[model samples]
Structure formats: C-alpha cells, structure tokens
Target: MFKNAVQLFEIFGFKLRVDPSWLLIAALIVWSLSTSYFPEAVPGETRTLYTVLGIIAMLGMFLSLILHELSHSLVARSYGLKVGGITLFIFGGVAELEEEPHDPKSEFRIAVAGPLMSLFLAALFYGLTRLAADGTEIGLTGAVFGYLALINLVLAVFNLIPAFPLDGGRMLRAVIWQMTRDLLRATRISSRIGSAFGLFLMLTGAFAMFSGGGIGGFWQILIGFFILNASNGSYQNLLIKSALRGKTAQNLMSSRVHTIDPGASIAELVDDVMLRQGVSFVPVVSGERLLGYVDTAGAQSIDRSEWGMRRVADILVPASPENTAAPATPLDQVFKRIGLMPRRKLMIVEGQRLVGVISLSDLVHHLALEQEIGTSLRG
Candidate 1:
C-alpha cells in the first residue's frame, strides 16, 4: 500500500498521498452514512440528499485526517526532521519521518500532535453544528456537521489508546524512552504493550460479534489486526535502523559493481552481463557520467524477441534523488530511501560519477554481521 500510493497534493512542502486501499474505506464510509447514518439523523431526507450529505461528511472526515497528519508533519519539521510525506491507507494516515526523532521530547511532541489536531477539529465541527442548530436549521448539512464532530472526537479518543504504531503508542514509547534512555528498549516495551492491546481488541471484537454487534464487530477485528501488524512492523524497522546507525553507504556498498554501457542491448545485458557475472543489477554509464541502471526485473519486462532491439538506455530507470545515495549518507537512511523504490536498490553516487551499488541483500548481510559480533562479545 505504501509503495502503491498516489500523490494527491503537497501541503507545506509535505506530499499528501492516498493509497488505492483507502478508496475502500472512503466507499464504505459513504455507503454507511448515506444509507443509515444520515437517514436516521436528519429524518425524512430524500435519497439524493442523504447521498450528498454522506459524501460531504466523508470529505469532511478526509479533511480531518489531513489536518491530523499535517499537524504531525509540521511538528516533526519544526524539530529538524524531514517529513517524507503523508500517505493515507486502509486504517488512517501516517506521516513518514525521514529519520527517527533525536530525543524523547521530539518523539512525544510529534506523536501528540495528531490527536491534538483531531481534538481541535472535533471542537470546531461541534461548534459549527451548534451554530447551525441554534438558528432553526435542522437539516442534512447540520446533521453532517454533527456527525463529523462525533467522528472526529471518536478518532481522537481511539488514537489516544496507548497502542504502538498509533499516536498514543508513540507517546508511550517516548515516555519509556525518556525513562530508560534506550530507544530500542523503549520501542520493544511499547510494542509488546501494543500487541497485547491488539489481542484484547481482537477478543473484544469476537465477543461483540457473538453478541450480534454485526459490522461494528468486524470493523473492530480489522482494526485490531492492523494494530498488531503495525506494532510488529514498527519494532522490526527500529531494529534494522538501530543496526545500521552511524554506518555510511560507503561502509557497506558493493564497490565491485558491474556496469553496462548505455548503448548495450537488453539481450546483451541479460546474456553477457547478468548471466555471465551472476549479478542482478548493473549501472548504465556513458564514460564517467552515470546514466541509470538496469536490473533483471527490468530486463524481463521486454519481450524476449524484442530484447535484441531495446537499448539498455531504453529500459534503464533514470537515476533520481530517491534512487541515488551519497557515500556519506547513513546506511539506515540509504535503506529507507531504497525501500521507497520498487527495485529495493540504490546507486552510490558522488556528483554524476557512479561509485557503487547497494541492495537489500547488502543490508541484510551487514545486519547479520553485526548480530554475530554482538553475540561473540556477549559470549
């Protein structure tokens, strides 16, 4: 979902994206509100009116989500962290920070920002609802605003439940980090708590289902599974980042990289380069200037018959800032950059000159070596 996200807009230098999966949530919200929520709240509204109200309410909720993520991005940026972007996915939105927080205080501030924004939105919507209701306007618009107010408040409260990967969970981790002065330890503790909370939620969901809670129970189950996955993923990511901390791209990059000329045919790349060298990736170059790269995956995209006709340059993915890492870039940061790309690889570059390449395999090997050394020391 993160990889497939489509950029919607840029807000204050932070890109806002929506994953295709988010469309499911949007559709569900519109369906639920139009069929049941608005009809019940407004009482005797036409089907068309209810549909419009539902759409407006869903958009309002989306706006609230944006505000929530925006607040987090702004705070993170204020603390000298890069806000990679915000991606709205199945559960909600996440503000991808380019690096971890430098301290517990920064983490706490960033984590708390989202819920605070939600709370503020809730109050604003409730106030507007009141203003509309006070003037004898008890219609679809008023009900929609009222629903938005309630949902935003619920969002705020749900996010504050001290579950890892959630806003509240980060706050919990921050507090633990502050206390222990160990970020990894703090993360582990928070993740364990989050996993437990997720299990509890799942059990509650099952109970609710048995008690005839219907769709709401299923929703709870879905949320619980999401939280569980997120908590586990958060811990694993921190582990990877921790292992690679302070290491530079130069330290781990495969300097003995294979290269293919821009004029080389894709067929030659496959037979003479990839097959002969047993290398999956090779840089495309013209003398000292780096052009891009070609991998087996890219090669396979061309029909075997057309491989002889296609130039390496034709299939070479042009080097972008995202796909290129400087020698001085932190290894973990390089990993982060590469993960955002489909190829899961990065070209090491200093200016236009290609130096080396790094792949997910390199990262795994480096991490394994670190663990081995740690184990030896402990032994």
Candidate 2:
C-alpha cells in the first residue's frame, strides 16, 4: 500500500518508507472513536478533551512504532547487516535489513531489541503519568497516555508470538541455526512453526467471524490472512534455499555437445541434421570457439529441408550475454532468473566451447533430487 513515503526525512542516515496503509488505520481509529467512544462521553468538555487526546494517542503510536524499528535497525547495522530502511505500516513497523544475521547471538539481539524498546516506551509513558506533579485529575491526558502505554505493551507481547516474518520467528530461526549449524534446516523448522501459528490464528478468526461478533472478528480474520500468507512465503523461501545448497553446474552439465561450422556445404550440413544429435539447436563455432546457436527451423528459410543447409553464418541466433551462467553459480540466482524468463536456457560455457545447457526442466529435476536427499538425510 506504500507510495513514496521514504521522502519523509532522514533519521540518522536511515531512510523511512511509511506505507500508505497507515492512513487507512488512522481513519479507522478516528471513525471508531466518533461512532463509539465519542457518543458515550460528556458533551462539551469530553469532546474537546478527547479530540486532542485522540490526536496525541495517534502520534504516540506512530512514535512508538518508529522507536521499535530504530532499535532493530541500529542493532542490525552494528552487526554488519545493511539497514535498507524502516517501514511503518497498518500492523506495525518493519526494519529492513539487507541480509539475515550472521549468528544466533546477533539475531537474538536484533529481535529482542524491538520488544525491549517497546517495554521501555511503555514504562516511560507510565512514569510520566505518575510524576505529573500538578495533581491533575486522571482526565483525557491520563487516559490517552495510559492507553498508549498499554498499546506498546501489547505490541511487544504480540510480536513475541513465535511466528515467521515476525521478530519471534527470526529469533527461533537464529536459535535453531546455532544448534543445528545449518541455516537452511533452521529456516525449514521455523517456517513450519510459523505456518502452524498461521493455521491456529485462521481457525480462531474463522470462529470469531462466523459468530457474528462484527468488527473485532473481521479484524481477526484480516490478521489471520496476513499471517497465513507470510508463513507460506517463508516456507517457500526455505525450499528454495534447500534446493540451492552445495550445487555447482559442473557436476550436472552435459559435456557432449554439437557445434556448427561458420562455413560449410549446405547439402552436407543437412545430412548432419538428419542424424539427430538429441538437441534442437547447436552452437555455431570457428576453430573451437563459440559464435552463436543455430536451430533447424532457421535453416529452413533457405529450403534446408530439401537443400540440407550446413553453414551457420546467418542462421544462428545472436549469443545473448545474459543467457550464460558460470559453472559455480548459486542455484538461488539461477532459479530467480528462470522465473523471469521461463523459455530461456543457460548456455554453460568454460571459455569458448559449449559446456552444457541449463533449462527449466533441469532446475525442476534438481529440486526433486534435493527433496529426495533431504528425505534421506532426515530419515
């Protein structure tokens, strides 16, 4: 829902991107107060007082979310992760770290820092209420400040719910990683835990919804849906990480490849096509070097079906730079590229000669193999 909110300002060199959805939340709060809370209070005095308190309450919440995120960003930066920015959204704020923490201690520090700051803010607000020194009746100022304090407390506890994409989940991942010494395995375990939490929240929300409890139940269902989606994404990310581990193209590349000469008799070349090299295309080459790849369909432009076209001079497609992959490239990067260009194939090459080909099917097969290995390892 965010637009261009990072333009808000720079806070200690950290950029902020407030999601546009936060405005929707603010609107909801105001509407809720006008319809429900405002109607019950005394007319003139209560209205003016609460109007100011409501504004203060909203501002306090925003400030609290920002402080919570700042705790995370500062710790993550100290530990060497690049803090991209902090985003304040409908639910809460998120500190965007460029990468996962390097160790469990670092992760635990980063995760706990947010909640601890929330607790501190809560305490600070409570202290201000008690030490007012003016002995003013616990009116709008007291009520709003008290409510804001409680909000921070609730935010802290709720975030510690041990669900992925949440602070607690990351802490869980960090602990498990420290124990198992395998990040992928740790991620898998934590994702499962988050997914379970999502299911539980969904069931609870569904029960609340079907009971006709109205707005509160509807909100529960909304939160449930968010948790469910986030958990599923976490699980998929683990699967991707698992498939990519320790994989090198050299181990799976095809060594036997066909090549076409830049200049050859078209009639004789047509005979090579009839032999069936088990590939739809062959790279055009000159003296053990690559030029480009040629397809049989292209040769048909010169009546190659009857004339037997052999020369790849103009028949080959241009060799694209992006289509090439290194033998030791990471599977995560490879898989990401494959999704962007489903029909594209990687030309695995050492120097000049065609080394192998990595197609969509190859990636699929690799994943299947990884699953089998994972199952075996677990067993």
Candidate 3:
C-alpha cells in the first residue's frame, strides 16, 4: 500500500516507514499546534516560541505513534505472525501483518496491544506534565507534555470504539467469534457495524460542516470515508483468502510450460522463443533440470549487438524463492509471492525439475470459473 514510503529506521527488527502523505499531515499538525494550540495553552508565549513548541509536540506525537504500532508488532511476532513493517500515512500508523492471527485469542491480543500502549504513554506523559509544571519557569515544557498526554488519551479512547478494523472493532469481533465459533460470521457482523459507524461519522461531519465547524468537519468526513472503505476492503480480502484456503500450486499451475535451453544464445531466445511464441518468461532448463529463468526485461538489458555473444545463462535470473515455488506449496502462499513479482509469475519446481508455472491470470481465471459455476467458496 505504501509504494512511495521512505524508510526511516528499524527498531526491534521492525522497519518504520513514512509515506509521502504523512508529510502533508505532519505539516498540518505543526501549523495547527504553532498557530492555535500552544498559543492558547501558554498565554504569554511569543509566536516563535509557540512554533518551536509545536514542532516539539509534533515530534513527540510521532514518537508516540511509533511506540503504539511497535507494541502491536511485538505482540504479533510473539504469536508467530510475520509483520511486513510499520507505515505512517496520512491517517496514522499501521502494523502490517503478512498473515492474520491463527485464532481469535491471538487476534484479540494483537488488536488490543496498540490502545493499551497508548494508554500507558498517556499516563506517563501526564505524570511528566505535572513534574514539568512544578520545575519549569516558562511553563512551555509542561504545556507540551500536557498536550501529548491529552492526545494520547484521545487516541486510546477513539480506538476503543467498537468499529471493525479498529482496535475496539477487532475486540468486538473476537468476543463474537468466541461465542459463535464462526470467524467469517463474526467478521461480517463487525464489518457491518464498522460501516454503519463510518456512515454515522460522515453524516455527523456533514451536519457539523453545515453548522459552521469548517475544517474540523471536513477532516471528520475524510476520516469517515477512509474507515468505510477500509472496512469493506478488509472483508473482501478475507473472502478471497477463504476461497483459496485448500488450494495449492499443483492445483492451479499450467504443466505445459515453455522452456529454453540455457546454452541457447540470447539472440535465439529473443528471436525464436520470445517473439515467435509471444512468451515473456521462459524457464532455462538443461535436461529437465531447472537452472533459472529469463524475461523480456533481462533480454532488453543487453545491447542488440551483444545479444549474439551472450547466452541465456548470462541473462537468466538464478532460481530462488522469489521466482520459484514447490508444486505442493499452498496457493495462498503462492498468491502472496506472485503479487511481489514484476511479471506476476512463479515457476512450480520439484527438486531441480521444473514441473509447471503459475501466473496471476491463472488464479483469476480459476476464481472466475468458480464464481461462474456458483460454487460457494467462501467460508
């Protein structure tokens, strides 16, 4: 989702990235705090002093967000789930988990970790605010701490609202899932609540805007739309995963795959195989043994004149987990790997032999057929 995110740093093996949209939000936060919040909180502060305090407060909020997401990542890892990373976007930060929790208990714990951490930070900052108020001469330091404390408290409370995809929503899902023993049904119920909540926020924002709330109302509307979209997307993704649960690479792969001899010259590959067969990717095999694979990108990298001198071996990408999967590998795993590939293809290999290949188009076709036949793949 964060295609344009910039990596900041890693903590406890979790990489933190900031999306480009975050810069806009960061600027707004600084502007709001400097011009309005800090000035009102500390009445005698100069404009410059307020701006400085605003920047400091914004930085503190940034840290607070990271710590909140980090708590989720740490707990998810403890449950043996793979975390892709944490990304800060316009809305806020997210701990991207590669897979869902195996059980409702694990999901509950993972979802609750973030808000709990926020609450802890809120208490800690409140205590610091009191200390700073007693010792500081200008009271600026205390004001900043006070703001952070209040914001964190707000964060904790807002997330505790039972809306799907939110911490509270997930907690609600966990409770329902435990009672009903049906995850999909629980998700459906929670997501519907989330969507309703999002709609309510949108209507509330619209009313506030007409009532002269201005920018604040606009922001509420924007956040409401984001929540509405995210809740629906999360449910759809679960449905797709459910449909693919029992499938494997062998079930979806095309056995009649095109292969090129590694000894073949790059010129022959580009002319005879790529152009004639209209195939962009072909496995480089030597007597049924898979070596690597070559694609249009690899072929285009060489100068036209040098194509005659180079062999397929020279341009082939070495077989690796990124490009190849075992035939018995689960389809969901293959689906994830295929999405990462530029060509959206994966060679199904058995030991050193190339058995078949799978592509995104193949998966789409299969799903389409299942839908056409009125198969109820969803759990």
Candidate 4:
C-alpha cells in the first residue's frame, strides 16, 4: 500500500493516484521482463526488440489493472456511492468507496464489473495473438500478445476464488446478502472463507519453501500475508457497521466537558488535567462555536518543558463536525480517519462551548450493550 497516496491527479480528468509501493512493484516487473523474459542470447532475435516489447507489455499490463479498478469505481458511482478514485498498488488496484453498498444488486454489479473488464481484455489480447501468429515477421508480437492473453485469463480465473478481499469473495458477499438479507452475516461468511484461503496459501508456500521451489513460493507467502491483513480488516469493518447502526454521538458522548481556548498553553492544559474532571481528552472551543480539540495526548507529544511555551493554537487539531463527525461515523471509519491518532475521543460539537467527547471506550460499551440486547431478544 501507499505510504500516503495523493487524492487526485489530472490525467484527462480521470484522476490517478499511484501508490508509493506501486512504483516499486512496477519497476520490479519491468526489470523482470527486461532481463528474464527478454534476452540477447536468444537465437535470431535482437535484445533491443525484446526489451521494447517487454516494456510495452508491462505498461499495458499496468494499464489493464487500472482499467479493472476504474470499472469498479464507475459502477459504484452510477449507483450513487461516493468514490475516492482508483489506486494502483503492489497487489494491483482498488477503487476506494466511502461506504459499503446498501443494495445487493448494486454490490453485484460493482464486484462483477472488474473481472468482466479483465475478461474483455483477455479476449482482445487473444485476438491480437491469433492475428500476429498468422504474420511471419511478427514473432515477438505474437509472443507478447500471447503472454498478455494468458495473463489476463489467469487474472480473471484467480479473482473468481470465493474468499474475502478478492473480487470473487465480494461477489459471494453480494449473493449471500441477496439470499440471507443480512449484510453482517454475508460479510462474516465471505471473510471467513478469505481467511481460510489465506491460510491455505501460507501453508502451500511453506511447503514449497522446504521443497526448494524458489521465488514462486515466496510470492505465495507474500500474497498470503496480504490476504490475512485484508480479511482481518473486513471482519473489523463488520463490527463497525454494527456499531454505526445502533448508536450516535449523542448516545456515546460524555456531556458537560471542560474546554480549552486557542490562547491556552500546554501548561494551562496540564493544570486542567490536575483537576481530574474525569477527563483524559478535552475539547478546544472558542466563543459559543466549536473549533477543534486538544488532547492531553497531543500535548504529551511535545516536550513537557516546552508545555508552558507552546500555545494551544499551535498544537490543537481543529475540526468541523461537518468534516469530522460524531462517534456515529461508522466505528471502522472513525478509526480509519483518525489512524493511530492519540486519544480516540472525537469531540462532539453542537454549538461548541465543549459539549461532550466520544471515546473508544464509549463505542465499545455501546457495542457490548447492543450484543446483550440482541442476545436477550433471541432468548
């Protein structure tokens, strides 16, 4: 994945964000093809021609991955989802959407669209391969075309595996959602399959390693690791979806919290902490309106000696409730938006004056309560 991919870039207005890691992967692919697939020692073939063909093929393959992701984005957009555009990474690509699909039919279309595009590409390459094979002078063209055709065919078939984080897994989720009419159940089942698939890949890779099967085994293990992380995310997302459904910021927020002004120093904050208003995190407010927030955690990031010297305005994170959200933001989303951020509490702003704070503890408690209620209902 990218360290931090840019949101957009103008490439004919169809923005492309290249993941940082994608650059490395693409370079490695190019090198592999240039040296391994194209060689000067081959009889009756020029190294330059093979090199050029290798570059072209690799470029085309990258573009193909982009198109696959674009297909997902466009379909989701047509269904009124907010798309954050497609990103190319080590595993290929992903079209980031703001929320999970609300309708099974919409989910089906979005999931199917990617592999369908790959199949179309496979056909195109196959036709080119056929045409080149008939032409005597274009042996290199035929080989490259043939490779593309076969690669795309592999892509299409591989993605059909019913496991989490794969297109096939997503398709399975859509089908299950349609059949059971339960999104959580569908996600749980599909992701569990994905995790199982990951374990299979890992085990195979380990066997291959001991058997001296070489780099292919290494790739399998790496892919298995990717699957493990991705499926875990999907499972965590299920919990978030559930958390979002039953609660709001108001439901989780602790009311009548203390406040901080822009002019206040960390020294002032440290003094407030001493009062133990039962507050680990405090809201930063100005006038009767809201600004952002300053957590004791953020203050801790600075040198304690500098605490008296630093103003809250210099360190406090300002947030607009419109841009920021109540704990009501899907719990998965809240964690994602505030990744590894200090103090999980998101300030709940109404008209400001520091109304309340919603901490992770609050969301966790609410989720536990909801589970208990559901259990009781079943009983």
Worst lDDT run of 10 residues, candidate 1, spans: 133-142
By summed lDDT, the worst window of 10 consecutive residues in model 2 runs over: 34-43
Candidate 3 lDDT tens digits, 277-301: 9899999999989998999999899
Quote each prediction's TM-score: 0.77, 0.73, 0.81, 0.81
Ranking by lDDT: 3, 1, 4, 2
List, residue by residue over 1-379, the lDDT tens digit for candidate 2: 2455545777878888777888888777666554455344323465556566566678788889999999999999898899988888777788877666888899889999999999998898887766642464545556666767788999888888788767888888889989999887787788778877877877787888788877777777777777778777766666766677677766665666667687865554555752555566666778767777666576667765545434567666765667667777776677767566534566677677677777777778877888888789989
lDDT of 3: 0.90
Candidate 2: count of backbone clashes, pairs at least 3 residues apart or interchain: 1
lDDT of 4: 0.76
Q: Candidate 4's residue-wise lDDT over 1-379, tens digit each?
A: 3558765564433568877877777777767766776453233666677677778888888878888888888888889888766778877788888789979999989999999999999999999978877545436777777768877888888888888889999999999999999888788889989999998998999899889978778889988888978998887766666767644566666786787788888888768652456565666677777777776668778998998999988777777643356544555555455444566667665544456666677667776777688658758
Kindly give the stretch of ten consecutive residues in candidate 4 with the minimal lDDT sum: 321-330
Q: List the global CA lDDT of all models.
A: 0.89, 0.74, 0.90, 0.76
The superposed Cα distance between candidate 4 and the true structure at residue 93, in angstroms, equals 0.9
- lDDT value, residue 362 of candidate 4: 68
lDDT of 4 at 101: 90
Give candidate 2 regions above 4 Å deviation: 1-13, 20-23, 33-56, 130-144, 175-186, 249-323, 342-344, 349-354
Candidate 4 wrong stretches, greater than 4 Å: 1-3, 6-14, 39-43, 134-138, 259-343, 364-379
- Cα-based RMSD of the predictions, in order? 5.0, 5.5, 4.1, 4.2
